[model samples]
Target chain A: MSETQQPRAEATVTLTNDVGLHARPAVRLTQTAAKFSSRIELALGNQSEWHDAKSVVKVMRLKAKQGSEVRFRAEGDDADAAIRSIVDLVERHFDG
Target chain B: MSDGTVAIGIVSHSPDVARGAAEMVRQMVGTSVDVGWTGGNADGGLGTDAAQILSVIEQIWTPAGVVMLVDLGGAEMNTEAAIEMLPADRQATVRIANAPIVEGAVTSGTMASTGADLEAVVAAAEEFGG
Candidate 1:
């Protein structure tokens, strides 16, 4: 796997906020995701499917509880920025 | 001004509801893009009026496009009527998204602020369901 050429970048971040990925945090995530040109998505721990990170409904639907691990993935010109933004927000407790 | 063309509007049954939803969108997208809203019936009741929606549409009209988010059944109907009432040229640039009012407003508004065209903003709002 390490020898393969990767077109996308992925990162995992823990939801430490009291409400996890609820309304406010979800909104923040979606808005930030929209700023980047890449196609970004979020997934639960070891989940095979990814949810659209630019939709609040999709983000909230994950119901990722506090302390749950959410993985972020992006592909396109701004993949790095997209992943960085999600990781920064999650690490900052979504600025709650 | 690359990302300053498109405008977003919100329409609901209650004036407060429309205002609050617009505020949520503004918080997410900032004040760069235009966001207009109108709510309530002609008599200030708990229903939507086509004229009210039309006025908001006209207020937010732009060369790029305008995306409208409506609250319920009445809003949907009246919004279609309002769009029909616009001049043919203006009508061509307007779209009513089939999305939850609040969520749609925020998502559409954010995308529009990013300089997305009318179709892309509508797509982002509809992406909420999938």
Candidate 2:
């Protein structure tokens, strides 16, 4: 079987912040995602459409309210690290 | 001199609003781009001041250019007046973004932090407009 290139890193995290993914958290998420070279995208729970995670506008538009499950996918050499960092950011409530 | 990235100017009718918005941008992007803000009338009342806006524009001016975000129609007019007061060369480099003050400031600042050019930064702010 021939190997096919695909995104190998994915994770889903719940937004636990009081305001969910509001402007402040959205900025943090986009900034964190921008640090990596990988292409990262996000989707709300059970939604098929994914938006660019590195765009503050797109991230803010997601409007993922508190307790909403947000999924992240990354494809590139640093995909795993990117996903890990994003997951960590979410888990930490984006305080950093 | 700027770091070659577009700068952001925030103008609001209330001084507190302008400062708060600028602080928000700073918290989001750190010092990645130059940010300046002015609000309220000369007497410290709730009104936009063209002179104050002009001063902020000059304070944060950069060769890359600057995108100004205004809170209301009056603020926009004052910002425009401020721009007109600048030298023709500077006026050419400054733009008033028709976007909400707080949202536009954040978006413009973030885009500028990535080294986006003036038009790109202005577009980012305008995208927030209804």
Candidate 3:
């Protein structure tokens, strides 16, 4: 869904780590996203295909390098928390 | 109540190797899983220790069982000995799969975290490769 049209909370963050969303960061993103009750999805660039935020393999497939922008959307009881946690992790570069 | 009981452990000859692989598995599987690992001998040299393997296993053991992924050679031998040291009941709950250490740990951890039974997790690890 478009950012403005999402039925739940959504947020966008730019990956800043030099390594981008590689193995380590991707793992952290998936782990943090999995903690919430929302059904979250992520998208990159102009691709409309959103991947399951909880799947490491799928997140890795995004190949979103540093400076790439990732959009996260979640719909559930805790959609807001899911968006905030994920945005926080991305902003923190997965605490690297 | 039938979910979230399985766990995985990784054994290698180098602590860094085990730690790196464990981190990857934890990332893919999420922190909800118990993906423990150990490497090298007690003296910190290049060798696998049965005691260390046993200790790692015990840390993540569950009634549903634990699956272990070993790097090879001494690691496999030490892991087998570690399992042998466990009591019969605990022994029955553990399984060592013939799978690549990194790939197997990632696969098993992912499967276990999703609520697959021990047998299914072991099968996924084994099936990960040819």
Candidate 4:
């Protein structure tokens, strides 16, 4: 889907907390992304696997497991801010 | 209560997990289910406020009794705490439980929606529980 879209950057945010990327954080990230219209992909640490951020099911299947760093990229008019917002959210443990 | 045994909702910090569990139940019971969730704040942990949980109960819970599957326990713990502070009436109508928030909710939701009785619902939950 990124084949034709606005500028996008892959920002990697490490899962610093003990909980890992568990369901709570994943749901928050997915919910936050649902607020915008864009193609969002979440990649697990150093893995080629990336799932659509909009689909809560697909993201959960990634099994982000704790301590897994996720690289998020948003493709859209507000891709930059969307990516930053998600990065900040992940950094914050979806609000701990 | 349930046209089946019980109605179950996975009240956790993660909406995806809740929805995932709901998805599983929908497949099992082959019907839609009532659902709710919260968990976005960093320090917020994985629990919604008791007030929010009540809102879900009022808004989503239906004829069959509902089983609340919370994640953690103790004072102020996520879903666990939320379930505790429920009023006498709400508590009477709902059953609070602990298990794999996702898998348990799905199984319970499916069984509950299918008109399974409380014992049968609890049994299904215990059958494939974490």
Best prediction by TM-score: 2
Against the true structure, candidate 3 has what lDDT? 0.82
Docking class of 4: incorrect
| Residue B1, model 4: Cα distance from true site in angstroms | 5.7
DockQ, candidate 2, vs. native dimer: 0.38
Q: What is every candidate's alpha-carbon RMSD to the true fold? A: 3.3, 3.2, 5.9, 14.4
Q: Write down the TM-score of every candidate.
A: 0.82, 0.82, 0.64, 0.45
* Higher-scoring candidate on TM-score, 3 or 4: 3
Error of 3 at A66 (Å): 0.4
lDDT of 1 at A45: 91
Candidate 1 wrongly placed segments (more than 4 Å): A1-7, B1-5
Name the better of 1 and 3 by DockQ: 1
Q: Write the per-residue lDDT of candidate 1 for residues A1-96, one digit (tens) a residue.
A: 466544688899888889998767777787788888789988999888988887766887898899899889999888997898789988898882
lDDT of 4: 0.62
Cα deviation in Å at residue B50, candidate 1? 2.7
What share of the reference contacts survives in each candidate? Answer: 0.29, 0.21, 0.04, 0.00
User: Considering every candidate listed, which one attains the maximal lDDT?
Assistant: 2
lDDT, candidate 4, B9-31, per-residue tens: 56656556655766655554344
TM-score, predicted candidate 3 vs. hidden true structure: 0.64
Model 3 alpha-carbon miss at residue A40, Å:
1.3
- Could you tell me which residue pairs clash in candidate 3? none
| Ten-residue stretch with the least lDDT total in model 1 chain B | B1-10
In candidate 1, list every pair of residues with a backbone clash: none
The candidates' DockQ values read 0.33, 0.38, 0.10, 0.02
